[model samples]
Target: MANKIILTGGGSAGHVTVNIALLPELTKRGWNMVYIGSEDGIERELMTPYTNVPYYAIKTGKLRRYFDWKNFKDPFKVITGAYQAYDIIRKEKPQVVFSKGGFVSVPVVIGAWLNRTPIIIHESDVTPGLANRIAIPFATKVCTTFEETSAHVPSQKVEYIGAVIREELLQGSAIKGRNTLFFTRSKPTLLVMGGSLGSKRLNEVIRDSLPLLLQEFHIIHICGKGQVDETLTHQAYRQFEYVTDELPDFLATADLIISRAGSNAIFEFLTLQKPMILIPLPTSSSRGDQIVNAASFQKNGYAEVIPDEQVTKDRLVQTVHQVYEQRSIYMGNMQKVKKRDPLLAIIQLIEKTALSDRSRNKKEK
Candidate 1:
């Protein structure tokens, strides 16, 4: 019989990318998989086409951290999500639930708990988010991408697993050959990304500074497709509005990267052993989680953090220059951080949990 499994969480690529990184391993191991996500999320578009697995979407929204009148409605949504999840759990009866923390996962986690399903939650950031923090109490096994997360979690149940980066990142090709569009002067190339929907603020900063940056180094910017138009094409930038599958080629070519401090992107760079410049979204961000994440990586020397106030043209140029001049320092510090083949670890965890569930079932029978 198939060992049933369900995966949840999707507000950003940080939450969705974990499943992408692990799907190959799950498929190779022949485990049956189901996905639980929000109806309006990118997961429905990304995961459904790739896997022939059961996927269910729940109605969900984030509860504001600050006082807002709309905050009153969140409790009702939580109740509605729980009911939706209850139906999914009853129909699928998954043996184990793996969640990447997000608002959408709250309902699934609660429903799984009520059904007595084994729960595993993975926090991909240096700190746990609100959903994962709440879910930690009930999670049978809690996994984290960063060691520092244990402090805020207040749970002895947590396990520190290196970030589960997409498998391709771990096996990146060695830096070699002449400078390409993404690299110039064989001086490390820095990749700047703002996530799938893209960051207008980051894009504007890059636009302001790119004219100077291009003279000294090569850059490959993943300007979100939504931002692409005749106006940007006229800019003197070697950029990609869209390149889905060849993303590995771009990363393999980069020597350094400038990116937002999304846990998924940061870990991807870590896995590739590339130096990073992280700009957490400013204080006014909707979630305010990226600022905390960026600071944690900076504290540990995994990357350097540049506050939005200091993201001027001069600062951007100076920061890139400083890191390039001291390339060895950044690369050396990154070594202290861990990198591994997460495919094996995920497979082992799933198989172990699945077998344990089957054994318990036999005993009950």
Candidate 2:
């Protein structure tokens, strides 16, 4: 039988991208992968393009840090998800479980733990998210993008694998990107993106500052799904709901970028040597993880962090100019970062986990 593995994580593109990065390596080693995620999440939409990967959806509930009526009801959903996951685990009997730390993965991790499967989780933030924090004890190994993140988790369980960047992203073409979008100018390309869901704040500021921005750069704004404003039809500005296959070229064409401080996104930018201005999610809405991520980038001169209070039309315009002016300094710093091939290391860890299972099985026989 092929070495089988269960990969679980969803709710956002970040959770799915890490798994996508590992899929090629896993397939090369002849591992059959099953994905367990929420029934109607972005994961399903994202994974739909993969014909070989069988997907299974189960019940899932969020674990909120704050009070809500759903708090009581969600636990039952979690229990239901756990039971569903347990059944899937029993049937799949995967050699190991690798979770990417979303709400849906909690039950899958629990189910895998119940089945005596080794669990590995990769966390992309400097601090563990709520789901990963809850899933930690069950995990045999915890992979992190930042070394500082390991300080919060069990030291023995941690390994710093850096970020898992998709190989396709490394192959983006500036010329192809510009030509595809009909960018005919000598001006720089400014790429603006919020997270996968899109950021209302970032969108508003970018749209507000566009009159000043478009004068200097050929702008490509991935203004989130449904967040596109049809009223702004400037020839120099292009807005996309999102790009799947064309993102690499689009990224390659970018001279400067504006984005949220998601670990995977920023790391990809750093790897590409793009000077960026990161507007992290406000702490009131999150655990302040993005702030920590943006701060680290600033500390290392990889990117500039724009404070929430400073996120306005004027400020956005000023910051964009500043980043454009100081682009070389930021690029120089990003170039200094020692890049690691997380896909290889993660695949090795995943394969190692499966190999041990075979050893134990043989010994038992």
lDDT of each: 0.77, 0.91
lDDT of 1 by residue, 51-112 (tens): 57777989886766888887888878888998899889988988889898788999889989
Using all chains and alpha carbons, the TM-scores for the candidates as numbered come to: 0.90, 0.98
Q: Which ten residues in a row have the lowest lDDT in candidate 2?
A: 333-342
For candidate 2, what is the TM-score?
A: 0.98
Per-residue lDDT of 253-298 in model 2, one digit per residue for the tens?
Answer: 9999999999999999988999999999988888898999999999
Q: How large is the C-alpha RMSD of every model relative to the true structure?
A: 2.8, 1.0
Clashing pairs in 1: 190-256, 191-257
Alpha carbon lDDT at 34, candidate 1: 90
